[model samples]
Target: MLTLRDYDNSDIEALLALANNKLVSRFLVYTFPYPYTRADAEWWISAGVKAEGDVTKVIEYNGQFAGSVGIARKTGWRDHLAEIGYWLGEPYWGNGIATQAVQQMTDYAFSDLKLQKLYALILAPNTVSMRVVEKCEYELEGVLKREVFKDGQYYDVHRFAKVLKI
Candidate 1:
């Protein structure tokens, strides 16, 4: 069974362990530091985990911490939209975990958060993540060509979004 919950002090070690892997960080944005350190985890917990309007959750698998997912509330011109992002440990990959977590979070974002729409930006090479969003009924809105520079190269970002029924 998988569950999503708030971050706590006890989650530090598990967070560090799962987040420190290069494979897990490869498709993630630059903000998710590759060499994931204790300081990084601490700062994330304090600053990123529980933002005022956003929903950030730890993915707990069978009672153990495995990954994280969240819906970031947008502002200014995009107040009705929320950006979603998630990552799981390498060990938990390909077991339907990402799909399940994404579905659950999407529901929360729409129903509990009362957001109008949710979006996810996927780097071109990460087809698995693209599929993850697709599985949750998000539609491909467009592609931003060479929008992000990472690993000494530029990559296209595929924008996917889903809107609430009403």
Candidate 2:
């Protein structure tokens, strides 16, 4: 069984272990730090998870910390929208865990958060994530060429979104 819940102190070790991987951080934003250290995990659980206006949850599979999923509300004129993001441990891949988690987070963003739209900006090479959002019913919005500069190289970004029915 998979579940989403708030992060706790116990997750620090698992989080550090799973997050400290080049394969995992390669596709994520630069802020996600490649060498995800204990301090980073500590700060994430103690403060980052509680960032104002954002909702983050730990993805637990069979009672073990498997990954993380979250939504960040857009500000100002775009307050009606939010950007969804998620990542799973390499060991947890290919099991439909990310797809299920994205579906759950999408529902939560629309219903509980009352957001009208949720979107994802996927690195062009991250086809697995593109498939995940697509499976969740997010439509391809557009592609921004050379939009992201990561790992000393420029990569395209694919924007995908799903709007609330009303």
Candidate 3:
């Protein structure tokens, strides 16, 4: 079974081990450090996990740390919206873990958090993620050309969003 829960110190080792991979970090934002060191994991557990206006959680699969999922609520005029992001350990990729985690987060955002909309900004090259969001019923809002510069190159960004019906 897969679950989303609070981050704890026990996740440090597994987080570092699963996160320290180029393939996993390739499509992620630049802030998600490639090396993913012990200090990074410590900081994440100590500080990053508790960011204000953000709901971050550890993805647990059968009692093991599988990955992470989170949503950052927009401030001020866009307070009803939040940006959702998630990533699964490379070993757990093809098992539909990400899709399930995202679905859970989306439900949490709309029901628990009272969010009106949730969106994901996926790099254009990440077709897998696009498919994931598509499966979750997120509509393609638009595309921003060359909006992201990562790994010393530029890439387009695909914007996908799902809005609450009520």
Candidate 4:
């Protein structure tokens, strides 16, 4: 079973253990940092975890901190839209954990957050993540050409979205 919970001090060790991997960091935005450290987890638990509005949850499987999933609401003209993101520990990959987490989070965002739509920006090389969102019913909105530069190279970003039924 999988669950999403608010981050707490107890999660620090497992958070660092999973996030420090280069393979996991490579697909994430630069904000996630390459060599995730205790300082980063501390800051995240201290400040990054949203106390209100949208939602950011630590992904847990069988009572263990496994990864993170969150929805970030847009401001200004796009207030009804939210950007969702997630990552699972490398060992947990290929087990459909991300897909389940995304589905559960999407339902929460629509029902509780009152979001009208949810979207994700996936790097071109991250076909795995793309498939995950697709499996959760997100449709491709479009592709941004060479939208990001990471690890000394540029990559296109694929945009995927799902509109809330309400």
For candidate 1, the TM-score is 0.96
Judge candidate 3 at residue 124 and give its lDDT.
93
Between 1 and 2, whose lDDT is larger? 2
- lDDT of candidate 2 over 72-138, digit per residue (tens): 8989999999999999999999999999999999999888999999999999999999999999999
Query: Any residue pairs clashing in model 4, and if so which?
Result: none
Deviation (Å) of 57 in candidate 1: 0.4
Off by over 4 Å in 3: none
In model 2, the worst 10-residue window by lDDT is 29-38
Question: CA shift at 126, candidate 3, in angstroms?
Answer: 0.6
After the best TM-score superposition of candidate 1, give how far the Cα of residue 141 lies from its true spot, in angstroms: 0.6
Q: Tens digit of lDDT per residue, candidate 4, span 1-71?
A: 99999888999999999999999999898889978989998998888886455588999998888899999
Where does candidate 1 stray beyond 4 Å? Answer: none
What's the CA RMSD for each of the models?
1.0, 0.6, 0.6, 1.2
Backbone clash numbers for all candidates listed: 0, 0, 0, 0
What ranges in model 4 sit over 4 Å off? 51-54
lDDT accuracy of residue 158 in candidate 2 = 99
Please, what are the lDDT tens digits per residue for candidate 1 over residues 45-109? 88878787788999999999999999889888888889999999988999999989999999998
* Candidate 2 local lDDT, residue 19: 99
lDDT of 3 by residue, 1-166 (tens): 9999999888899999999998999999787998889999999999998999999999999889999999999999999999999898898988888999999999999999999999999999899999989999999999999999998899999999999986
| Error of model 4, residue 158, in angstroms | 0.2
